[model samples]
Target: MAPLEPTQPDCVWRNVAGAGKAECKIWQFPTRVSRCTDATNVTGFTWALTQTWQPPEGQVYKLNFDAAIFANLLASVVGVIIRNDRGQVMAALSLKGGVVQDSDEAEVVACWKALEFAIDAGFSDLIVEGDNATVMKSIASGQTDLSRLGNIYDDIHCLARGLRYMEFNSICRSANGVAHSLARYAKHLDEDIVWLEDSPPPALEALLAVSRLRLNEELEFTEL
Candidate 1:
């Protein structure tokens, strides 16, 4: 048999024509070095970590809320869930919010609706929670909101004043999971829905584990 010849520029086929004529060449690859900045540059900056939902102390009730916007549907949806110090659902709302400009607007609408829901439920001592940090910060700081969302902000502020004790806070998305799910579910609804002392089955299932843990904590406290 004949020795093989090189087929492609980078590859070689040996023993094609004859043993002595066989051409076998080794290929060398260049070493590649990537220079990265000092580890301190990346590790130096730190951000405050977010926390999950916790039942409010005393007789306060927490309203965890979120919104979802569907551009194709030209609509927005809001979810508001009120839970007591025991972390059990007291009331929940799913509203088919009208058309909104953007996510900020959607969240603002959700915030307003949350206050409305709380007030309608006769909840005076309440903590309003959402995942939009900017909106929450604006409300918490009592900054003079001037954006389009300012209208909703004003409504929420006025309504909040009616409560004896109220606070606006932002939680991480992990803590707002149930509200997120409910808002996403509302995207399919054409009309608003409200449940008193009840929540959507799906959201209830999602909150079950958390509620159980809270219940265990309460039992421990009782024993103490």
Candidate 2:
């Protein structure tokens, strides 16, 4: 047989009958993932959604979340801060209840408040983001075997049903850093919600400064 001639790129050769090398660039951009969730996945969706974000130039979004996240009833706080197309805070929700729990009531109440706020703002469409992936799945699936969460899930659906358009999805913890801060801030407070448009707490500020220093050190190390 004769040798094959070159075709496109400056590479060695193209794969005609055989497979090609597998190399793909991976990026951590957030997007929507639908679900028809069962009972067990209810809480995970709620926590998972906190780490997600969508690009600007989209419709208004309402993220219902808890600051004190309870996976197996542990004391892990979670929060969500959602921004709209205008970059204003569309919703900032945090929660901390007894025994470090995933309080369906907390999620429901927060969802209600956000829904009310969105309605008042006259947003026609919305995307509900959450930290708990399981909760998100349950919401999308339209049912759950969990009694307590089931009730709140119904409430969430009811609220969402009233919306002109809406979506639900999940994200990772690093992606939901802002919301995590807000949730921690909310959980440790003595009284009602605290709104911050300008600054974060002093501890977070210090932590950020330290992080910047570490990054600088890393850059210097790499240069060497």
Model 1 misses residue 19 by how many Å? 98
TM-score of each: 0.71, 0.51
Where does model 1 exceed 4 Å of error?
A: 1-50, 212-224
| Model 1 residue 92 CA deviation in Å | 0.2
Residues 68-104 of candidate 2: C-alpha lDDT, one tens digit per residue: 5545544444454556564456545444444424454
Q: Which candidate leads in lDDT?
A: 1
* Superposed Cα RMSD, model 2: 15.4
Cα lDDT tens digits, model 1, 65-130, are 999887677888988889888777898888788888888888988888888888888887776777
How much is the lDDT of residue 47 in candidate 2? 25
The CA lDDT at 140 in model 1 is 52
On TM-score, the candidate that comes out on top is 1
Task: Provide the RMSD of all predictions against the true structure, rounded to 1 decimal.
Answer: 23.0, 15.4
